[model samples]
Target: MADDKKKKDDEVKKEESEGKKDADETTAASSKKKDDEPKKPDVPPVIAAGLRLERILTVSSPSGGSAPKAAAAGSPHSSDSATHNAAALTANVEAVLHSNPGKIVRRWLGTSSGTSSRATLADLSKGAEALLSHDGPCATGRELVMLLAPPTEGGGEAMDVDAKAGGEEKKDDDEKPKFLSTAAREYEAWLISLAVRLLWRDGRHGDAHSLAGKGVSILSAHMDDAARVTARAGAAGSLGKAGGASGLYPLLSRMHRYQSLAAEGLAGEQGESARAAMRADTAAAHRMACLRRDVDTQATLLNLMLRDLLNANQVEQAQKLLSNSTFPDSASNNQLCRYLYNSGRIQALRLEYTSAFSNLSQCLRKAPTNTGLGFRIAVQRLLVVVQLLMGEIPERNVFFTEGMVAELSPYLKITQAVRRGDLPFFKTTVAQCASRLREDGTYTLISRLAHSVVKAGLRRLNVSYSRISLDDVAHRLGLSCATSAEFVVAKAVRDGVIDATIDHAGGYVRSHDLVDVYATTEPAEAFHRRIAYCLTTHNDAVRGMRYPPDAYKRQLEASRGLKGKKDDDKTDEEKAQEFEEEMDEDY
Candidate 1:
């Protein structure tokens, strides 16, 4: 019992020692923690106060404070990183615009592959068509024009098209910058054409005219440059492959339609004063379409203006359109033919029979047969009357062309009466066909044939008789008297149709001896021209040929087989003498 009590006392003492050791360890850990802990640094009072003021301003701005509001608006959304990236992108885009704007623009449209060029024209056409039907042209087309147009100072942002009239004033020469490339000119041309068409179709003729008539009138400047553009097709894109501005055709067709509507209002037989007033209005409309520098529009303007002039019998105005400079050969076949036809009619009205014959005949040959049969028929009808008026009998086949027999039958009677040299028959035929010809629009033209019929009768008389008195000729021609017959013969003689002299005192007309035309140098000129052309073609053929392969081969074989005999013979005096004698003999 005494030993157990001593052990417990030792255990209690050991427990007390353990507790004291634990307390000492905890105090050391607390000291280490205090040493390792971080302490706050002292702050400057002014900076701290200013920072607190900035926070207060950001959270709730003081009155009259603009800085915080601006900061709030200018700051990016919750995603500040996106806003930061966008700003960088905007800077990059601005850099590109300042450096290579065209390059960047082309990059967006993509490059042309083999098939892409074909699709390029198609895409452009589709986009143009779509724009025409949309309400967005004033929106998008205005933007496109600003993009394609010369860059201006201040880099004005494209505004709504309601301000387009204001933009028109912005087209200044000095401010114009070269922003478009040659490839882009096509886009410019297409835009201009589309704009004109839209303005035209919208019935804003005055605006269309004004827009097209601007000093930088799109058509007047670009059209004449077509030959140059097409000539440089290889340097430009594949524009030539797209037919070198086929967009002009449709645009021109619309212009033609516009002019046709103008002409139709004047087609009716209004009173003289009303007709004149309407014609003046039509002229003004066409004149507006005439831009100062555009050849195609100028020509078309001249053409439409001349049509009214010719119809009004204003020969002076017709002279301008009839001038050689009015029509360009670059125009379509139909336009040229119509121009030639109208000019011919003007010439005929002016009594220039030879010039009329030349122009009308050329027009008849070029008039598209299948597309506009009425126009072709009109041309043919004019040709018949003009041929008759020229005192020349048209051949039977002239009236019997393929697909034209029906249209020519009425004129066939006129042709026959002219050929037969029967004045009464001609008069009777004209009387019978007067209503039909009037509806065909050739009644006035055919009525003018009365003088020609008398001329034809006189021509036959000169062939049949050596001398005919004016009295007898008047009786045969169904004229009222010999005095009129004498005057008529005098006119025909001066006109060079009949080789005859009118003897007024003797009251007889004398025929000069007719020479055979085949004996003249006129045929020789044509033959010589043909011969020269043939010789030129032959020379070109000969110049293009290479050394004859078979002949060279034969010569080579002969040299190889001659065992040096050819060389020896060439050097030998006797062989050379023989060769010279043989050549001289042949010569």
Candidate 2:
């Protein structure tokens, strides 16, 4: 019985082992089937095509890292292909070139064996049209037009041309060759006009003018009778707006008779020529009217007009324009102030010191800090001169001691260095005073005068110093030393009443006689007389001790005798010293 039971167990174990082996085999087969299964065929052709076109059309680069896969797909034309067909076409084309170079030559040059090469405008135009029609966003069309366009004199060669040929082309070559059909040239003109119009809208007036002018010239050259008139008128209008009056006027006059004829022709209901002329005239007139009406739109125009008036010495006209024009109040102030300041300058030039002072002072009051500097200096200049003329020591001294001289000194040096023509220092001083009074400040009056003095001094001497001595300057002017030397020097520098210098010996170096220096430097007999008259009138104010009338007469005679004498024959320094001694004795 035990033997029989063991046999049964062995049989059961063997059966169990066989069942396990079968299950293992089945599991292995299933795993192998999954491993061998193909990946789902790539994205559908239509879907892939959509993604590629989207990438090409959009401004940004393609995302999702799918571009490579899409590119790998057969040409877009092949519904089932996994790569781009366009790339394949390009590759095929390249391979063909490698294989048969002569084929490309034959295709491009037009003959089977090549050698016939005449590029016409029609060909270029057709190419441009085709490029523009393309759905791609590439710059093919615009770039082609730019490439065909003629270059400016200094402009580099066009990319389409051979570099060597580009350098040899004449500047006038930028124009389309006469061989080009008029219609083709017209189309080019239209393109240029469109570009200029776009630029104008973008506020690039300079570029717009350049391009518009070129287009207009071309249209005028090649456009038909009717088209030419229209083009001329359009170009005139654009030039007027973009380049202002200077550029527009010439074109307008050239088209004036054409415009009249057009108007007359239109009244008679003439043909296209007359009608086009009429249209051109109408456009030009519209542009002119628009320019006139919109004059206020450009701040530059108003500013330039005001500046021109000032430059022409037309102060009244400038003032009138400033007062009548409707400019932004804030902007108008700077120009208005400038006008007023200039008017004051004119008054001072006329020696109307009081009127000059008023105008400048008013301007100074209204001007901003940055703009106020000029007006303030003007006021100071006038005050200094007026004080000197009136011999008001206290007032003069106030200007000198107040640090006004320091500010003006450097400017004076520069003016002197440049050797600008003689300007009436007194007038400038009066102008400065008017500006300062208008502005209103404690130091305004003095500061302006001081700065003016410095400017005038610089113009005369071209050297500035930290301090100047009034006493030494007075002595050089043949006047007794004043209590405030700084004040005298400031006055002298401001008014051009005297030329003063700082000596190496720590004293002020000044001309001994105003008339003598004026005569020597200016060589104007009239100026010399004026200096003498001014000096004689201010003799008492200058604080020089008066000698007896006879003694003065003798000195004057002696000076006249010394005139024209050879310098080598007479000791000028000794004579000058003797003259000083005589004056000291009289004092």
Best by TM-score: 1
What would the per-residue lDDT of candidate 1 be over residues 1-587, giving only the tens digit for each residue? 99999999999999999999999999999999998998775533322322332333223322333433332321223246444333322222222211222222223223222222233222333333332212210223334333323333553544444567676677986443222111222343344444444555656554444344331334334433443444443213222222223323334433444534333333245334444554665455445433222234445655666776766668877786567444643444666787888888877767787778877877887677667877887887777777777767788897888768998998998888877667888888888888888776567677888877888888888888989999999888888899998888888888876889877789899999997979978699769857965785587468556454356766886978973665575756676565544432221
Least accurate 10 contiguous residues by lDDT in model 2 = 108-117
User: lDDT for each of the candidates?
Assistant: 0.55, 0.41
Q: Candidate 1 at 584: error in angstroms?
A: 61
Clashes of each: 1, 37
For each candidate in turn, the TM-score is 0.45, 0.22
The parts of candidate 2 lying over 4 Å away from their true place are 1-298, 330-587
Quality of model 2 by C-alpha lDDT: 0.41
Residue range 163-192, candidate 2, lDDT tens digits: 757645755744422111111222233334
